[model samples]
Target: MTRIVVLGGTGYAGRHIVAEAVSRGHEVVAVSRSVPTDQVIGAEYVQGSALDVAPLAETLTAADAVVSALSPRGDMTDRALEALTNVAELLSGTSTRLGVVGGAGGSLIAPGGPRLFDQGFPEEYKHEAQVGIDSLAMLETTDSGLDWFFVHPAEVFGPWAEGERTGHYRDGGDVLVRDDEGKSYISGADFAVAVVDEIEQGNHHRERFTVGY
Candidate 1:
């Protein structure tokens, strides 16, 4: 079983990913600002801020891979991105692989053209989405020796709908995927499935990929 560490495990998408990882028989260590009293079965939860490097390093030691699902609310996007970058730095020089959760804003709407957020992104989400987009760019330029993969979800994510474990999704190369209704969306459960699938199969290495139903 792979020893995996999940940053921001208490959040919406992170929690789903943690559940999926544990269900697959992988040993998971979840790190967040606060530990859930009712933690997921077969997983270890650690309470710590992602901004702190020492504790994060200690938590991630000997981990097979690290999944970063950390996000900031509103204007805290820059701070959140900085903290995540610090975590990436700590994982450098280790055997751990990094899988980062990216924002739809960074994914291409067209080849070599505008991003999702660029094309009429909601003002309310602009700051946080930009943070995610910037974080993906930072990961791309990181000189650290860590092997990393960035996964971008569709326009709709989180616990908006109760979606079943289809165990199926279509992967796209940096571009967004839309259905017959000319819309793009993914359930948090399906997104978690995609994340764990990548971890187990090791597809889309050292690059970014987008997912949709």
Candidate 2:
């Protein structure tokens, strides 16, 4: 089984990812600034900050994949990109795959046209969205030997709309995934499923993909 390291493990997206990975019998290490009251049974939670990667060197060395579920918010608003960049640098030229959970804003509205961020996006979320875009750009320029993948979840993905796990989702390459009604959404658990699937399948190397119903 894969040994997975989740940087923002205590967060919403990170927790789901840790749970999904553990449920699949993969070795998972959840790293965060604080510990959670509830924990995933089979996963190991480490109290640490992603901003400082030097201390996490040993913990990250043997990982088969390192997933960055970090969101640019609160104290991390300005440093999220730095943390991810450091992680990318650490995994460069290594066998460890870097998987990033990006925002919907970076996704294209069409095949090769406007992006969701170019349209009227909420002002409050602009910073976080830009971080996602920048993170993908950073990955694109990394060492060719560094295998990686960026995932943009549905427009409505978050704790607010935490739906049940259906064990199914669609892969929208570069474009946003929406239903017939033009609604872009996916449950947290299902998104985690897509992530683990990618980790195991290694389908899209060094590229970005969107996930939704």
Candidate 3:
């Protein structure tokens, strides 16, 4: 089984990713500030901030990959980037890969042009979206040399809809994924599938990929 660590594993998207990783029979270590309430059947929970480097390194040392699901609050984007850089530094010489959950703001709305957030995004979410965009920028310029992939979710993402695991979704490049009805969304479960699928298949290295229905 692939040994994996998921930073911020208690949040909405993180929880689903953790569950999906465990369901696929991978060994998982989930780290978050607060402990998770819902018990993931096969994951070891670690309580701590993603900013804690020493503990984060200790958790990542034996892992095959690290999934960063960290969502920065307020102006904590810098702090989040520092933590991610620390993790990348720690895994620099190893074979461990890093897969970050990127934001939709970074995804392209047109070919070689502006992003979604640049087109008058809602003020309420603009800050958070900027953080994700900044994180992706950091990943691109950093000299860590570790294998990394940024997975960007569509405009709408939420808890998994109650149903069988379909493992079906559309994947796209920098552009957003939209359907005929002019809707762009992906179920959390399906998003998790995309993330894990990338982890297993080893595609889209050092780049961002978008997902939707």
Candidate 4:
């Protein structure tokens, strides 16, 4: 079984990813500051912060891959990028692959066009959005010696969507994934499916990809 470590494993998207990965019989270690309300069976939960990676060195070093399901919230605001940098450095010489969750704001609004952030995303979400964008920027510009993959979800995604598991998804490059009707949406459950699939397949290496219905 693949030994997977999920950072921020109790957050909105992180929790779903942990559940999905565990369901697939992967050995999962969920790292979060607090435990989840409903923990998945057969998964290990560790209480810690990604901000401090020194103590987590062993956990990260031994993992087959690390998923940055981290979302900037509360004190985490404006700190995701920093945390990501530390993680990349910790896994620099290791064989662990890094999978970072991306936001729709960083994705292109169209093919070879401006990004969603450039078009003026809602002010309320700008800070959190920029954190995701900055994390991707670091991945693209720096040579941290870490094999990284950034996965962007649809514009409308999260636990609130409460969508069904169609067990089907479409993957694309930096461009946002939309249906024929031009609707951009995906359920959190489906996003987890895409994430775990990529981890197992090792596709889209060192690239940013988006997934949606």
lDDT of candidates 1 onward, in order: 0.85, 0.94, 0.83, 0.89
Candidate 2 segments whose C-alpha is farther than 4 A from its true place = none
TM-score of each: 0.94, 0.98, 0.92, 0.96
User: Cα deviation of 126 in candidate 3 (Å)?
Assistant: 0.7
> For residues 149-210, could you state the per-residue lDDT of candidate 4 as single tens digits?
99999989976787988888999788999999998898988999999999999988789999
Best by lDDT: 2
Greater-lDDT candidate between 2 and 4:
2
Per-residue error for 130 in candidate 1, Å, reads: 0.4
Better of 3 and 4 by TM-score: 4
Preferred candidate (lDDT higher): 1 or 4 = 4
Model 3 lDDT per residue over 1-213, tens place = 999889889877788899999999999999888786786988999887757778666778788899989877644555777777777777777888999997888888878868899888889888778878878887888665678899999888755443335799888788988888978788888899999999999978888899987
* Residue-by-residue lDDT tens digits, candidate 1, 1-213: 998889888888898899999999999999888778878988899888777768678668678989999888644456888788888888777778999988888888887868898898999888878888888888888775878899999877767665777788889888987777978888888899999999999987679999997
Q: Indicate the TM-score of model 3.
A: 0.92
Best by TM-score: 2
Q: Residue 202: error of model 1 in Å?
A: 1.3
The sequence of per-residue lDDT tens digits that candidate 2 reaches over residues 1-213 is: 899999999889999999999999999999999888899999999988878899998788689999999989889999999999988998898899999999999999899959999999999899899999999999999979899999999999999999999999999999999999999999999999999999999999999999999
Model 2, global lDDT: 0.94
Q: Rank the candidates by TM-score, best first.
A: 2, 4, 1, 3
